[model samples]
Target: MADKIFRNGEIVDGSGKARFKADLAVEGDTIVAIGDLKDMQAPEIIDISGKVICPGFIDMHSHTDMSIAYIPEADSLLHQGITTAVTGHCGESPVPVTNHNRSYFRNPDEIKDIDLPWERLETMGGFLGFLEEIGTSLNITPIVGQGAIRSAVVGFSAERPTEDQMEAMQQLVEQAMDEGAIGISTGLIYPPGSYASTEELIEVTKPVGRRGGIYFSHIRDEGDKLIEATKEEIEIGRKTGAAIHHSHFKAAGRDNWEKAEPALRLIDQAVAEGLQMTSDMYPYTAGATGLVALLPEWAQEGGLGDIVKRLSDKATRLKMVASMKTEGFFSIAEWDKVLIAGSSNPAYSGKYISELAETSGKTPYDWIFDALLETRGQIGMILFMMSEENVKMQFNRPYMMVGTDASGMLFEGPFAQGAHPRAMGTFPRFLGKYVRDEKVLPLEEAIHRISGLPAWKLNFKDRGLIRRGYKADLVVFDPATILDKADFINPFQKPVGIDYVLVNGQTVVKFNVHTHARPGVITTH
Candidate 1:
């Protein structure tokens, strides 16, 4: 007898094949049987007639690890039918902690009220062990962040690494790979990681390539230099032999909207040349990041303390503003398009830069500097820079996959600040709007991108499919009613029609409500 059986559902097995009616059985944490399981007896049987049964969605890119310690239940993600997440993305992870880089481990402003044991979770192995000990709501495949690794060895200096330092960095990558990291991720636009030269990136990624791990990167620039950045990423992959993945792939800013297709062609050319290349994007047009990203890279050097000190000086502040204006930073002509996604000050939360500036009788630059100082450089901003047409076009591409690029949050909690709607509604939005309504791609292909495609990319052998003997991570939803309700004004709203979700054969969501189950595990390549 099986532990449970799901009967009468239309199965889309995450293989991009047509759906078919079937009954699936699960015993313990694995799917024991499939096809006609009506003859089998089980302790519990679920009749999911008329519902679509598919493999649980795998978020190709996420930063959930940053807050998973506090919100272990992962309410927002479970509600959207995500059973696994590729975390530690965009060159940010909570590991490789040392005396020289302890302060840079966690963003103090992002996490509050919870006491985390930083010492015990210092290295990649230690962090994975801690997650196993405490349990999580979704399986996490952690990518060792290059930024954290660089900071651990060389602090935040922009100076080139010494030969000894380079060797030490390579050793860290090897250690992380040995400790179950799937790959090394880089936020090339951010500090520390951004400071690295192309040669340094190729050298560091050599170990990951040798170990069959992917090199995921948020490229240096997504605006005027989008094509060049894509080429740079391809060169790193060509030199290191590592599979390359572009994180949150986008051509940002109004002036660069037409660059999307050309940048993607660069990826296709690389793929044709036999280099493994892929990219992921969220459904929304706007992108979110720290407000500090507004400053010139020079001003963003060192730590938060250094940045705050510089912002306090009137002369330096004016110089930074002038540089931003001259460079047309982020290709912005209007400050109204920039909204505060998160802030330590409630007054600034959910408001646009232009609105706040106008109300205070200050210029946008002055208001921005004041806000950063008031919050100690802990503000988050959302820039509406991408074209909607480009977003739809990208999703239609065969190599493009979906990712939230946002952290998990609950409706009512400290974690529920002003967040991008993607955090709570990425998968459903992609399915409901793009696939079901707009007909961007066939339903089967859309499901595959969120499931099998990402799983195959990460080399997950057992999950991301509905085969007998595979791990029984699944989701059952109504195709017609599935839709994402979360928006910029109310990001905490959950999606509808996600009837049931299972993680490792245990029900984590039933009737669209979380069961608070912690059956998730730490997955590795």
Candidate 2:
């Protein structure tokens, strides 16, 4: 006897293969069988005719480390058929916090409104325990953030770590792995991860390789220095012997779009040489991050407080302005592409830099600086920098996966205003627009990107596949009708056609509505 059975569905087993007609039976938190179950005895039998049953989607690169602590229901994630989220991407995790570096780490301004109940956790284990105690609607795994570890020991300094500091950082990585962190992540574009050299990264990730954990990175440069950065990332993986996973991989700005192919070639070359490497990307060309990221790396050193002080100094401000004009992948003329995605100032929340500059009788530079000052370095910006052709090209790669690169946000609340639509629309958009509408990728391949592929990256044998005896984390949806409703202007809306979602054999979403079920646990490698 089974707990429940889903019958009369087309099953896509999440292996990038063909679909088959089958019935799946659930017993407790595992799938008991997958075959013809016409006579299977169970307390409940759900008719899933005209729907496709597949393993629940896994967000390979997520930033819900702190957001999950606030909104544990994970309404947006549940609605998108995401049963598991691989959090702590781009070198932002909530644990291993010291009084010295916790406040300045990650995107604090985005979730400033939510009163996080467990912000004081000091270790990776404590952070995971807090989530379990609060109850989450989906499984969440964390990768120990390299930025947090660096900031805690180095305090936003641009200089190389001392021999003692380097050893301490390695110990932190080993400790985090022991405490259940599945891997290590680095936002190389963000400080102090940016401050770290290749040697430092290789040394610190030694434990990850030893423990068979992955090395996830938001590589040093994604535009002009993309190939150079990719080589460095691969070199680190080679030296450390850790599997490499790139986050939100893209070549930013219009001019650098052509570098996408060469970057892919470099990745392929690494793989051909027996280096294990993969990457995850959202479907859209536009990418979002903190507004302060536009500042030259030197200006951002010494943490937010120091940067704030430097922004107010005329000489320092002039140097920053000069750097902004000639230093980045984007020029001053492209300020319009850098729209304000979120801000503490309600008036400037959704406005672009060009519009805000004209309205405020200031130049784009002045507007950007003033906005950053007003928001206390908390403003978020969306950069429409990548080419659509490049986005589709990445999908053709066998190792490519899908990730929102956005944190979990609520439809209405402290975290809703100006949130990127990717939070709600990423998986559905990949399935609906990319796979079904545009025909860029077949449905089977798309399912594998979000499911089995990511699970394989994390070494989770029991999930990410609709196999007998695997964990019963699954989704059932109407392939013809599924589509993302969230858009750039109004991003708080959820998608349609994701009718049923089960996490750990518990139905958390039915008829596109969350049941407020928190069946998630911290799955560690």
Candidate 3:
């Protein structure tokens, strides 16, 4: 490896330590040394006199599985200094293997949008190889999705895996771990994953503990049933003895915000009783998801096809309307707080359901039923269901990490058309609003939540810290001007003041702009 020296920069090092001045030397992808510039001799050197060099930010949770193929440069994320991301969250991802019913890895129909060219690898090694061939912007490791695997083993039917099917799922997890999946993930609220029983989850995730990987999920609910849902998760953790991490764990709805203590207490008890646990949360008051997720299980029984069929069936739709009138997904009051996130049909993007009802001359409930019937259940919404004070209270905890529950995307492209704003605005929003502006958390603690904490938790041995022998995935920024510019209406704007971002010794972002460099690698567990 040829030596390259980065001379004279202040290093934050991701250790929650105070910044210190240094000259860093890189040999190929890893930082070989860090010291005074006077001691450095390198074949090539770049002077970084007035910048802060830190360990690359690790996106603890991201949804870049399919989107990475669309935008390999990760132009937006790299500019914000994200060097590593854990994709395939929410139990959605494309895998490599193919079985008789459906292929492995590439199982769930969510990935059907992408024409998966490489499906026979059937292992993590091949998936990594395919990503390398496809090109990418940052280091990434995939979590073998239980939902995709379940869809592969037992089709997308909303039912439990039979005993035989259960064994097949067990085999799938073992195979995935052998391949390179670092952990297992599921979004219990999203079917066909929602249909999985706790025992079934325990059986499948037990292998993760056996293989030394973690188990994480978006549990069945984060609302009124959050306490029960949390206990259910802890029960699974207790049974499997797997290290567990909860995803986007904010208290939602009117009365649930007060339940954060008991929820965290459950995790704390699990820890005391000897189950290693951690969790991540986005620092926002609103939560985003599809309208389908808001429907009752019976309403979304089969799949998108069945959903469309039911929505279009006047009789079935009327029955659903009656059921939803009293028993909505989250709660009754939450109805007032729901807002449309991104709609492919710009005629409705960013409009609140209640507001739209007034304009369209219908009750909010009637409008929702009509909209679903009209759009065929394809629309998504962002709900200001989370309590703002609760978001701050949760983020203030030590165990919580940060994640953008969406994909990395460019400002334009039809692919970016109707996605949540989390993808574009998460990391910067944390630094700008929470840490700098609101003074919710100090910068060191915020960086720890975003970078080092996750690195240690994920066991990415060589990439989390900014020190000699570490990977040169680094973020340099002018903290004062660092802020996310993406808003609810136009949520694709790139952030400002992120001066330089390097991934594995290559400069992907310089002067706060993408440099047309693809330095990211397919990271393995």
1-525 per-residue lDDT for model 1 (tens digits): 799999999999999999999999999999998899878999999999999999999998988866787677889988999999888887887778876688766657644577878677888898888888889988989999998889989998888999999999999999988998989999988888889999999989999999888999899889889999999999998888899999998888888899999999999899899999999999998888898888888888897888989999999998898788755354453598998987888788888988999999999888888888998877898889889999999987788999999877787866688789999999999999999999999989999999999989989899998898899999999999899999887788989989999999999999878899999999895
In model 1, what are the clashing residue pairs, if there are any? none
* RMSD values, in order shown: 1.3, 1.7, 2.8
Q: What is the full ranking by TM-score, best candidate first?
A: 1, 2, 3
* lDDT for predicted candidate 1 compared with the true structure: 0.89
TM-score, cand. 1 vs. native: 0.98
Where model 3 places Cα greater than 4 Å from the true spot, the runs are 1-4, 39-50, 96-126, 326-336, 373-376
Worst 10 residues of 2 by lDDT: 105-114
Error of 1 at 120 (Å): 0.7
Off-target runs (Cα >4 Å) in candidate 1 are 106-112
Candidates sorted by lDDT, descending order? 1, 2, 3
TM-scores of all models?
A: 0.98, 0.97, 0.92
Q: What would the per-residue lDDT of candidate 3 be over residues 133-207, giving only the tens digit for each residue?
A: 877879887888887778778766877778998998888888877867888888887777778989889999989
Supply the global lDDT for candidate 2. 0.87
User: What clash pairs does model 3 have?
Assistant: 95-105, 95-106, 97-104, 98-103
